[model samples]
Target chain A: EPEVTQTPSHQVTQMGQEVILRCVPISNHLYFYWYRQILGQKVEFLVSFYNNEISEKSEIFDDQFSVERPDGSNFTLKIRSTKLEDSAMYFCASGTTNTGELFFGEGSRLTVL
Target chain B: TQLLEQSPQFLSIQEGENLTVYCNSSSVFSSLQWYRQEPGEGPVLLVTVVTGGEVKKLKRLTFQFGDARKDSSLHITAAQPGDTGLYLCAGAGTNFGNEKLTFGTGTRLTIIP
Candidate 1:
């Protein structure tokens, strides 16, 4: 089965640095989303994208966070300034319409030192 | 906050034992999905229950949606070591709201051979 794929399975960056996490959603899926999980915490919604624009975002998604679909198939999340609290597992997901069943990528672990 | 409260945060069971995990919410959802995640990976969808009181079976695993569509449960029968993982539940609404998912804290299962 086709699955979402993410690059840089693990990332380590200095605080205040810029970092970008990349994802290739399942081919032919329309909606994309980004979620984060702090160690020992529940997964939190970051943002969701459709039609190359952000459709919805949570409070955690602030000025430091941005998402783009620069290409037809790839969705990317960029953090302009990384914070220690930004260290977490970032998961990318895609889904078709209707019930919107999501398929998530293996996740990109981000560690802001 | 739209919280998904999951019961039994951790479980250690012998192989061939049965287990059930619960995900409850006060906010009604358009659909509830169950996912199993191994450490260091994103969650993988196992089943989705959209309608109230719906039940779906995937081999030895059974999923049920609550009568109010506000809760769901995952039951595993005769679980094996391979079934040991972090089980998560997510909720989606029908509001054209980016189709983002609100996830549970997850239940960690350890099956001993």
Candidate 2:
């Protein structure tokens, strides 16, 4: 089965540094999303992208966060300045239909110190 | 803001036991999905329930969508040790072309052999 793939399985960055998480969604998927889960917390929606632009975003997706589909296959999330609270597992997902059944990547664990 | 609450955050049971986990919300959803996640991995989609009062069975697991579309349940019969994982329920709203999903708090299950 085809699955979404993420790069940099684990990243450790200092406070105020920039970090970029990359994902390659399934080739035929039309919708993409970014979600995060803090340790011992529920998974939180960050943003959704379609047609090469963000369709919607949550409060957690502030100015410091940005998502780009620079190419047909690559979707990337960039954080301008990482904060300690930003430490979490970031997941990238994609779906071929609007039914909301998404396929998720293995996730990128970000550790801010 | 829409919120999904899951009951019994953690459960541990012996193999072959039957168990149920629930996801409830005040807001109605266009669809609901169940996912299972193991440690150090992203969530894998288990099932999706769209129509209200619809039931779907995957092997020994059965999923039900409430009549109001605001709740759902997962029941596993004759569960085995392989059933241990963190289960998450997510809901998608009725907005056209909106693919953002709101995830529930999650239920961590441990099946003991």
Candidate 3:
């Protein structure tokens, strides 16, 4: 089965540094999303992207966060300045249909110190 | 913000025992999905329930969508040790552009052999 793939399975960076997490969604998937889970907390939606633009975002997705579909296959999330609270597991998901069945990539664990 | 609350944050059961995990919310959703996540990995989609009062079975696992589309349940019959993982239920609203999902507080299950 085709699955979404992500780069940098684990990333550790200092506070106030820029970090980028990359994902390659399934070949034919149309919708993409980014979600984060703080340790011992529920997963929180960050942003959703479709048609090369952000469809919707949550309050947690503030100005410091940005998502881009640089190419047909690559979707990236950038955090301009990482905060200690930003340490979490970020997951990238893709779906071919609107039924909410998404395939998630192995998350990128971001550790800010 | 929509919140999905899952019952029994943690469960440990012996092999061959039956268990049910619930996901509930006050807001109605267009669809609900169940995912299983292992440690150090992203969630993997287990099933999607769209219509109200819908039921779907995958092998020994049975999923049910509530009549009001505001809740869901996963029941495993005679579960095996392989059924251990963190189970999450996500709800998708009727947003215009590829709806974003609101995830529930997860249920961590450990199946003892």
> TM-score for model 3?
0.97
Pitting candidate 1 against candidate 3, the one with the higher TM-score is 3
Task: Give the CA lDDT, 0 to 100, for residue B48 in model 2.
Answer: 94
Between candidates 1 and 2, the TM-score winner = 2
- Model 1 per-residue lDDT tens digits across residues A18-95: 999999998988999999989888888999888888888999999999999887988999999999999999999998
Tens digit per residue, CA lDDT, model 3, B19-113: 99999999999999999999989999999999999999999999999999999999999989999999999998986238888899999999999
Deviation in Å, model 2, residue B48 alpha carbon: 0.3
Between prediction 1 and prediction 2, which has the larger DockQ? 2
Report the interface RMSD that candidate 2 achieves against the true structure, in angstroms.
1.6
Interface RMSD of each: 1.8, 1.6, 1.8
Best by lDDT: 2
Q: Which of candidates 1 and 2 is the stronger one according to lDDT? A: 2
Worst 10 residues of 2 chain B by lDDT: B92-101
Clash count (model 1, backbone only): 0
Looking at candidate 2 chain A, the ten consecutive residues that score lowest on lDDT are A94-103
lDDT of 2 by residue, B47-107 (tens): 9999999999999999999999999999999999999999999998886336688899999
How far in Å is the alpha carbon of A54 misplaced in model 1? 0.7
